[model samples]
Target: MKLCTLVNKDCSKAAVLFNSKKRILEYISELAHQQLPDVSKHVILDALMTREKLGSTGIGKGIAIPHGRLQGIEQILAMVLVSEQPIAFEAIDKQPVDIFVAFIVPEGNNEEHLKTLAAIAEKLQDKSFCKQLRHAKTDQELYAVIQGDDNG
Candidate 1:
């Protein structure tokens, strides 16, 4: 599935000032609650943190794709966050990350999860696309950019 399809406008945020990986994760967990209110923020945070124990999601070049799977979610839930300042995330490249795109998917849908992860991995590698995202000054503009609107 398309990354845009998994993302909802209300679930995204822009220019967040969180300065650490844990804080960013926590914020996105809260953001995820906005999309799937039935799920607990603590649960969401736990899932993401559990994944992090295996490896850092930080992909380098100032961007990170932090995703996890949840038991109750039927479809993928995504939230994008751009920090006003870069934060340390134990990236493979050992660089701080400034952009984060977090996802939570159904626990049984490993195929969907991998496909979505690959799609975003390829898309986010585009410097132009990331530049547009970073340039977005507000949540509406960020959503527009993720949705491929030129005005963003």
Candidate 2:
């Protein structure tokens, strides 16, 4: 599925608001809970933190895609956050990450989860896309950029 299909306008947040990984993860968990009421925020945060233990998800060029899976969730939920200032994420490229696209999927849905991950990673790798996202000044602009149909 496309990133646009997973994240809508409501899931987009201002870059100036999120300045740390903690706030970013909290925002993602809250977004997930909106979709899956029974999903525990602590559970999602735990899973994400465990994944981070493996390594930072930052893929460079001002992007980070943090993901995790859990048993309680029935489907996948996503959140897109942009930071006005890049935050230290210990990215593989050794660059701070400013854009975060987080995903939480069901434990057994590995195939779909990976598919979504691949889509997100591949798309964000484009330099032009990163520039577009950086230029986005509002939630509407960011949502359009994430949707890959920016008219402004």
Q: Which predicted model would earn the best TM-score?
A: 1
| Model 2 TM-score, all chains together | 0.88
Candidate 1's displacement at residue 83, Å, is 0.6
Score every model by TM-score.
Answer: 0.95, 0.88
Candidate 1: regions farther than 4 A off = 149-152
Q: Which ranges in model 2 have alpha carbons more than 4 Å from their true place?
A: 148-152
Query: Model 1, poorest ten-residue lDDT window?
Result: 143-152
lDDT values for all models: 0.87, 0.80
lDDT string, candidate 1, 12-83, tens digits: 688999878999999989889878899999999999999999999999999899988899778888888888
As a TM-score, model 1 comes out at 0.95
Determine which window of 10 residues in candidate 2 has minimal summed lDDT: 143-152
